[model samples]
Target: MTDGKVKARLKWACRRGMLELDVLFIPFVNEAYDDLSEQDKLTFERLLTCQDPELFAWFMGHEACEDTELNAMVQFILGRVKV
Candidate 1:
């Protein structure tokens, strides 16, 4: 797929059933995804595969991922929304 198609797909994946996840993901994909390294892009894609409850736990500070790549991606998303 072309880069544009990949981005379109990622954008679709960003639209979670949960409003809170939507708020965090959609803007990040639009604004920050282009700036991510190839590996970080993969990491974010991996993160998108995780369950909503696990994502909520990590993003909300209830828990941290043992996988460093996943943790970093979680932090990357969280960093964008912190005041």
Candidate 2:
């Protein structure tokens, strides 16, 4: 897909129904996604496909990802928000 289309799709996917997930995801998509390596970009897309409760657990630091790729992506997103 074109970069514009990819971004638009990502923006739509990032809108999790839950406020907490939305708050975390939308900012990262807007501010950081374009700078990620191609692999990381794909990983982030995969992360978005995961169920919301699972995502919430990871982002809340209450659960950990067994997949290293996903673990790293979660950390990458967390890093951006940790001022």
Candidate 3:
């Protein structure tokens, strides 16, 4: 897929019922997605596949993601935003 198409899809995927998530994800995709290594981009996509509640907990530091890779990705995202 083209970069534009991939970004479009990622933007759509970033939309969540929770405003907090939307704020984090939408901007990350817009500003940072293109800069990601291909593997990290894939990891981001994998992060998206997680359930919202799980994502919320992880992002909010209520719980840690059990999968080390996913947890690292979560920390990466949070670090980007300094959250």
How do the predictions measure up, each by TM-score? 0.95, 0.96, 0.95
Model 2 spans > 4 angstroms off? none
Pick the lDDT winner: 2
Candidate 2 per-residue C-alpha lDDT over 1-83 given as tens digits, one digit per residue, 9 for 90 to 100:
89999999999999997999999999998999999999999999999999999999999999999899999999988888997
Q: Which scores higher on lDDT, 1 or 2? A: 2
Clashes of each: 0, 0, 0
Clash count in backbone of candidate 1: 0
Residue pairs in candidate 1 whose N, alpha carbon or C atoms collide under 3 angstroms:
none
Model 3, TM vs. native: 0.95
Candidate 3: Cα lDDT at 73: 87
Q: Please tell me which predicted candidate would have the highest TM-score against the true structure.
A: 2
The CA lDDT of each predicted structure is: 0.91, 0.93, 0.92
Tens-place lDDT digits, model 3, residues 22-48: 999999998888899998999999999
